[model samples]
Target: MDILMIVPASLLVFILGASIGSFINVVVYRLPAGLSVLWPPSRCPHCLNQLKAYDNVPVLGWLWLRGRCRYCKNKIAARYPVVEAVTGIIFVLVFLLFKVSILTIGYWAFCSWLLALSLIDLDTMTLPNQLTQSGLVLGLIFQIVIGFFPEGSSVGAIKHLMMGIVGAVLGLWLFDAIALLGSIALGKTAMGAGDAKLAAMMGAWLGWKYLLLAGFMACAVGALVGGVAIALSQRRFGQKIPFGPFLALGAAIALFGGEAILSVYQGLFFPVT
Candidate 1:
């Protein structure tokens, strides 16, 4: 990890990630409201005044402005810089783990999609199809592009592409099937088709085996959280718990830890002596 730091490159990557995060904030705010993300640009929600260039420099801008709109002087939400910082950290992690490869860029995109979608779902309880479908398409396209730059990696691009396709199909069908069964059992909308689509997007990056682990983690954690909320009287009976956040959490853990855990499982269950 220390060896891959590459201070100059990592700093640049962090800036790039923060910029992407700023764009994500735009998408999250506009997409749910049926507004074009590009048109209005960054502006104070209160004053409707467009932000100046210096006032929109990711984390630094928020600090410099003291979290107030320059023109209107309206207090800004702290969430903007928080999102930017978290995204920068996530990007740094991806770079450290994968180094400077096309794969690293793909993972960066994967993490960004998950982060943006998670924020939107947390806010609106809906996962837009546009983002998920775009992620799915890009994931497959990355597999194709990676073929030309194998770099002696173990997983060939073609095999990875097949795995991605199978993983996506399985994720869609299995999650939807679970949702159907849950609705039948609970007599309400337990989960929506958006979750199934999100699963497909995740599977495109995680592959089938890792997707299964991530799915299990999501369901298990979601149930626990719901139980805790009920116990604390924070949620009413039969109220919906947004699943996208838990899914993102699971995907993060799977991306970082799944390979090691799966290897241990294989060694224990199918020991080669």
Candidate 2:
């Protein structure tokens, strides 16, 4: 694409992502409460006033309103605009990396879901099955469609599909095994089923190798965060902390840089045959 076209296309993608981020705020709020995401148009939580279209215009609206509800002057959380901005940034980054393609769309969808799930898990310590299960199904469907493309023969397509399936199964089993062992060691439940499902969803999208990389990254980051929390007296040792955010973060890293990182690791440790 020409530089002129790239600029406009990037802007469009960013706007699109920010708009979806707005919808994601709703999903994050409603899904946890078991409320219908469609019903009850966007409203101010404090004053229960329905927001006008101008009030809901993603990051721009927040800035224009000075992060306060127009009706009640209630302060809006900074997270709203932060989410919007981050989503826009990530969308632009993805476009830069993948350009325009079905894979880009798929990754965008995956990233959006991961962002929502991470925030929800951070807030409630629950990774809702609604998102994870649906995402798993969608990932499989995406792989199936991609498998049929001319990039590979029919046999290779079948193999690719099988890898995705096996990845999902292995991801679930890996997390479950960790959960079970942790429970035995701690004498209580350590990780929830939702996390396992989340791993499975990621595996379906990322395949087994990247899934393993994501798992390792999640563990390393989770441990660091946990240690910091403990050191700051924010959390007691053995207190439950949500792992989904770390998993989501890891999956994102894997999505963006896993191949390069794996190549470097292999070069260092395994070397070329």
Which candidate number maximizes lDDT?
2
Among residues 3 or more apart in sequence or in different chains, the pairs in candidate 1 whose N, CA or C atoms overlap within 3 Å are: none
Residues 82-182, candidate 2: write the lDDT tens digits.
99889998899889889988788888999999999999998999999899999998888778767776575677667768878988998999999999999
Each model's number of backbone clashes? 0, 0
Candidate 2: list runs displaced more than 4 Å: 150-156
Per residue, candidate 1 scores C-alpha lDDT tens digits across 1-273 of: 464558878898899999999999999999999999999778888889888899899999999999888888888889999999999989999888888888799999999999999999999999999999999998777766676465655467677788889889988999999999999999988898899999998888888999999999899999999999999999987899789989888888899889997899899999888
- For candidate 1, the lDDT comes to 0.89
Where does model 1 exceed 4 Å of error? 1-5, 151-156
Local distance difference test values of all predictions, in order:
0.89, 0.92
